[model samples]
Target: MSENFDLIAVSPHPDDAEIGCGGTLALLSEMGYRIAIVDLTNGEPTPFNDDPQVRLNEASKAAKILGIERVTLDLPNRKLLDSIEARMILAKELRRMRPKIVIGMQGMTPRASPDHYQSQLIFDAAVFYSRLSKWEDIFDGLEPWRIENVFYYYTARELLTQSQPLQFTVDISTHFETKKSALLAYKSQFRAHPSYNPPIIDWIEGMGRYFGSLTGCKYAEIFYGSNIMTMNLFKHILD
Candidate 1:
């Protein structure tokens, strides 16, 4: 949590990170970005397991599969509140990571889960954390970290709204298997989800194809971001 993370992906649960941005993470790691993942909860009380330690172990394995540092905030399962204390805890971690770019669940489409609301609250807090001077003693001398970009990842939402794409969609056809392998590492989640019936690998491949069709690729992963995303056009230079 203390290192300067070049890319930070926050998830409401263990597998949410991999499901939402696994391919993107692989692409980013290949491009040489130091990536980190933050899991807000242990994802307990699911049919997969009743023990918190079991879920944590699965998350650890998933992180290893994805090849990124992982941190868990240990928030309660199914019940999360965006209190000042919670915000401060998040701020402390953000300060520790010192990430240049922050990505989190949009939680925009599904307004049902408290975890979703918590994710949004974390996203908002991290965005403005560095600006405020008033904070706990933990943030005493921590310099304000103004992340260059904030990307809202689409997950649960079936329809993508019309908006400018800040991040280029990467064709994940080559890495589709790898992405699935990483996601399946979270045994607690995919084990129970009926949608993942046939096989996780097959499921991801189909998903990649569906998303890739948007950009003329056989398989692709999309991202929304904003940090000088525009490209310069020239006859000789490629965009």
Candidate 2:
């Protein structure tokens, strides 16, 4: 768990990461931490032009806006299966990246989306496999890697129901707008559809503003973890 990465966010689909923690990611990147986003699925069933190349281009542009690196796993979106094969693939990625903090949607419940469960499986495998020695074979015999902490952001489930309080909330007063702007890049996913009411873009933006108000910021993101995140108290908290 000694490897240092500012943050590694795993998403079930292309836009899940941004919708959940875009504000936090923007703030973290500004603070000089190396950031990475991994999209576990290719999101084929999404209401787009049905071209993988187009989605890839959109994702890349969005990553550029946030100043973070992006990686797509090409996993099937609606049909994500958390099998042993899937875990091994994610395990290899974790070992290669060696992130300090891992964040994702807690696959705690059977959600309507297969993407959710798929992400949960990846997160589950990543947490432990990243630290194991034998898993090195999964990543071309590379050295084992362990992240310092794991935090699950509130996306589908409420944080308090499953985990303790987050060590702290990111004050996204400055980055919230930028984060929203980045999210707008995925126009294909958020447009008003006949079946999908409550357009996602509107909902996500409102959630950011609402969260930000809690910490005196115009917009913000929330994260929760089971472990205590220690700080210098006086210095880190004040700063």
For each candidate, give its TM-score against the true structure. 0.82, 0.85
lDDT of each: 0.69, 0.71
Residue pairs with colliding backbones in model 2 are: 5-100
List the lowest-lDDT window of 10 residues for candidate 2.
230-239
Residues 1-239, model 2: lDDT tens digits: 23345678998877778877877787778777788898888676765457777777778877888888888997777888888777777777787787777788764545447568667777888677768886555568867877656777666443245445544556667887777777777655554353564466567667877777777867767766666654222124224
Model 1 misses residue 233 by how many Å? 15
Candidate 1 structure quality by residue, lDDT tens digits, 1-239:
25687778888888776877787677666656778788777777876576878788878887777777789997776887677667766777778788777778765445335677577786778668755665545585676677756776655443446555565555777666667888777666676565644455666666678779977878776566655443121101111
Instruction: lDDT for model 1, please.
Output: 0.69
List the candidate 1 regions with Cα displacement exceeding 4 Å. Answer: 109-112, 134-140, 158-168, 192-203, 226-239
Best by lDDT: 2
